[model samples]
Target: MNDRKPNLRSVRELTPALEFCTIHGYRRAYRVAGSGPALLLIHGIGDNSTTWSTVQSQLAQRFTVVAPDLLGHGQSDKPRADYSVAAYANGMRDLLGVLDIEKVTVVGHSLGGGVAMQFAYQFPQLVDRLILIGAGGVTKDVNIALRVASLPMGGEALSLLRLPLVLPSVQAIGAVAGKLLGTTALGRDLPNALRILRDLPEPTATSAFTRTLRAVVDWRGQVVTMLDRCYLTESVPVQLIWGERDAVIPVSHARMAHAAMPGSQLEIFERSGHFPFHDDPDRFVEVVQRFIDSTEPAEYDQTALRQLLRTGVRERAISGTVDTKVAVLDAMGTDERSAT
Candidate 1:
């Protein structure tokens, strides 16, 4: 059994104040560093705010970076509660409201990508720009690995795999079992699952992951997609960063998304995998910084929201469909409760 401790050199940037706040009575942890336009870095499932450790500080240098450990991950309180994308999105909005932050560049990775989109969709007024890193909500095609993890009894198995004492042996046995299984779906994803579990060896976090997984995925694949409602983006700029070899959510999703979003920029990390930012931190930083510098943040308006909602039907009459910047203002009457 490999009992090696995970190399966390990349995630040691919590030097910034690790703050705590309560949202809907659930205590959540977050790290805010640097100062500039607000940048909210949302991590993926089975992961926490530390997932952005590699790039958060660098981004902080230019932008106010706020990295939160979502409700059921990291140092945040994990309650047996709703793990749906909408719920997570709403939570994000409440967190920002607690801080009095009105707008931000919402950057999300993997499951975080789904959350980012939902946040943008649910509150286009709060997002200045939408950045998706190997995001999951653009398509229904997800790795069989996550789909299986979201199934019945899968949560129990996931918890066992992530147990601190059992993980090393589990990884060893899983590796051997994977070898015996050949090139099967389990073979491909078991290694990833084992690696992730080894890094995140907390039962509560693992449980939250499984619950979050079941929320967005199923045996068939991802259950939610952003394509149908992309037109809501309207004037907000969208940028996509994807690893060429992403196995969790194929890079094809990025390609398809870029095509759908005519002007949106897509940067493919040549040799990267699911965690492109981790795989090539320098490039990841470079691309995102450039994106922030070159683009303008989106501002929300009820009149615009009302107008943007009509774009699809309007575009169909002329061209096709489109997207939003999530910023909640008093100008948007009657939507205050929903936005906040």
Candidate 2:
């Protein structure tokens, strides 16, 4: 048997300190560590760079990991401005440019997954690979809670989060529920939900969260989907991971996305929930590292992308390989292509 001493340092100790930079006149906070191929980690809505704390340092051992708090979250500037997926994609490009980094293997979770896909679509030359975890922008079906939050007066309703003793009371309840239902999806997801609720007490954060939520979600469900353009990722290495019990963005979406994008890899955590990384970080890191080691970084070919765009994905239909369900869904909504 192989014997090795485990590194006993805390995750906070292993993680690099937050760094600041000015991009488009807004202060952005990010954590950077190690020196190798760049890996950009984008967190979900209502989350900050710290959400990746469990796996960031481990990934850093083999890659230059960059985790950023998207504008309006964490300590970043919360301006009354655009938070659309396309706009957030632009912000990522600008931030990377300011840091003098050219290309990255983009890894996104939840809402951040939408932004990562947009980034790859808008700036293909800057992306090496795409990794999505419990990502949005896959289907119109989302959690009813997100749909409710996107409704009118949703921002006003969030004021209830600020009531005195609300946070502590919820935390107490969550602690007890977590023990009783530890293996259930609700229990697996409660801690992260509580973390998000904790941030809602701040007026600016609440406002930013509401605006960001409404940008991609609505009372009906998700307003954006990348399935129509998923064919373009044929030239990019793609890996998708999801928890089988994911309540926020159903696991079926992962299977659907894998079907839409050819040659993509998919992994499902049997006992996890929305946050697979938090649920099984060691496996998460192993899967990521193995994928990175096995695949070559995609080289963006502008001429090829132009040709693909010109021809459109209709060729898949002629080849009898098109997913009819995806086609029907694509036809249902007008794709709001990213600008910039």
- Per-residue alpha-carbon lDDT of model 1 for 221-335, expressed as tens digits? 8777776556677577989999887778887778666655546788998777778787788999999999988988887778977876765523332122232211111112222
- In model 1, state the lDDT of residue 336: 14
lDDT of each: 0.76, 0.86
Query: Model 1 off-target regions past 4 Å?
Result: 1-14, 162-165, 172-195, 199-201, 311-340
lDDT of 2 at 125: 96
**Estimated TM-score for each candidate:** 0.81, 0.90
For model 2, how big is the CA root-mean-square deviation?
Answer: 3.9
Error of 2 at 285 (Å): 0.8
lDDT tens string, model 2, 114-222? 9999999999999999999999997788999899989998888887778898778888898888789787877788889888888887999999999999988998788
Pick out the ten consecutive residues of candidate 2 with the lowest summed lDDT.
315-324
* Model 2, residue pairs in steric clash: none
